[model samples]
Target: MISPEERNRTGRGCLLGNWVEERATTSLDKTGPESDIHKKGHQGILTVDWSSKLEDTSTQKSAFTSSKGTSAQQKGFRYELMKEHLIKSISEQVHAELTAKPAAAELHSVTRRDYTAGGFQWVRPTPSTDRDYKTDQAITFWRENFDKIQGVTAVRNRDAPFKKNASFTCPITECLDPNPENDLDTEEK
Candidate 1:
């Protein structure tokens, strides 16, 4: 009594449900192909063609071999088919298992502003001179004042405050002190 559209939808839904069920129940082994085939309730046999589903036919054939030389072709066919079926079923199970779990918590940005300055600095010592006395004295002066020059350079290269924390008040409103004066301890008069 169902309309054609309704029947089609129901059929598709049933097919999907059966496919999922088959993927879940199928054993991950190539021992037998007949065991992998499922019979849907009153909806005909669902014969999974594992060999045809494989992307590379030659690879599949080369990966498996049969002991029976005379009937090798037939045995190889069944073996490849069963192997593909087992691989597909196992992959589906793993995919389902991975997707079922809750997603990992998102990482929050931990970036903070560098308030204090005066970090370590490295400077290449100026090349010394062997020819002139005045030039050698100038090089010696440069070598002696290198640390002071480096310190000055460090002060000049201080990192600018992050835009989010540029204000005098605390960036986090909840953690802000009600009386800002209490933050700095005063000597008892």
Candidate 2:
């Protein structure tokens, strides 16, 4: 049986995975509700544990800085901390995806900040923004390597009616046209 911590971790990982999937699937819908949902996700509160951990680290760094640490040392410390978290999260996420069975999950720290200027907060990105950013980045990456994703074609068909041509007529107008013969004997009394 998975422990509570493991469950929490996995739940977090699954949440991220689901978010990524949503972003990928809704990549083409710019004006859709998914984008709004994604924006909300980014602005939502940071996880409590991650926030506490960041606070503790910031306090330690501040104490160390005040105690004989030079400016360069402070800069180095911040850089290392940010790098460590990024590296750690990326690696762990990959490992979890690979080794854990499809049923299993893990927590991923989507945000990271250094211990400086009131510290940084890890904010969970929304599916929409993540998708948008991913789409933009993917386009750039693919453009650089045109050979890849070149054959990938997407066809979008608009469901809403738009004026196709100047001669185009409105269905509503046709229905409401006041001609006794236009009813073709189908009009109800």
Candidate 3:
């Protein structure tokens, strides 16, 4: 069977494109006055869900950037993206699992009150061998999903509270004291 891209190359993809186009255009061909229900059914469902998810991810990314990420246990894009990809795959798997369940079957789940700081943490089933070399594949994945992560910061101190350069004692007092050679009093202080 020809893929969408292959079909498009031969100009036989009109029907597939039309189907997708029609789904998108369903909301625009409205006859009656604007109603929330109609909008929700046609446009709101996919648009609202996707946009809100993207927005949340964007916010997390912005927050992460302003704050620094962990240094010691710093994970590279290869590991992190692999984890993210696996997560997406597992979630799709679970969804598929649930979908496969009989209509009348009851679904049961255990509930627990968790206190983890970061939310999107996932365990990798398969680990990469080379831990030294900087791989382009991981970096590419990082760049691609960098925007999707809401709170994955590139900054140095992700946990450091937003300070206007307040002269608080070093967060890790035992390790080192917070001091600067050039005491340029910025607004953050």
Candidate 4:
């Protein structure tokens, strides 16, 4: 004997551990609005055909299940695309290098001396002695005229030489200067 206000508050009736609401037992009537069937349909009692919903869900599940195949195909396509791009870039670089002129620093010719048994052995070339005859003659002329050059001779006694001067005598020697005035001036002040 619940009041309408109490029924509205609880939204439905509960009796003996079972739902006693009339809406809970009523089957969905197809003649009703399509939106009412979806909103108010009771579980196991709804007259609405669920096979269509099941079909839609199965199609979605199938799409999800086949994702592995699609992903593999996508990966293979991406790999081939990347490989083609790399090859094209490499070929372009090689073509550019081939068409470009060699730099001045890289254009020099390298003389490689191969030390292999059958290869030509490189040796230091010696200049001919005939071309240097003037140098040798000059050296010989200097050697022959060395004794003729006027050079100072070494004296046996450094204190006495071949030519003696009055200035060369010791300060104490009276023969250095006979002038008594010059001798007195030569003494320490």
lDDT of 2 by residue, 64-94 (tens): 6555555565457789999999999999999
Clash counts per candidate, in order, are 0, 4, 16, 0
lDDT to native, each model? 0.50, 0.50, 0.53, 0.52
The residue-by-residue lDDT of candidate 4 on 91-156, one tens digit each, is: 999999989987677543444333344656779989855565543334455445544656534222
After superposition, candidate 4 runs with Cα above 4 Å error: 1-75, 104-189
Candidate 2, superposed: residue stretches over 4 Å from native: 1-75, 103-189
State the local distance difference test value for candidate 3.
0.53
TM-score for candidate 4, please give it. Answer: 0.16
**What lDDT would candidate 1 get against the real structure?**
0.50
**Which residue pairs does candidate 2 place in steric collision?**
9-106, 9-107, 10-105, 10-106
Instruction: Please tell me which model should have the higher TM-score, number 2 or number 3.
Output: 3
Candidate 1 Cα misplacement greater than 4 A, ranges:
1-75, 103-189
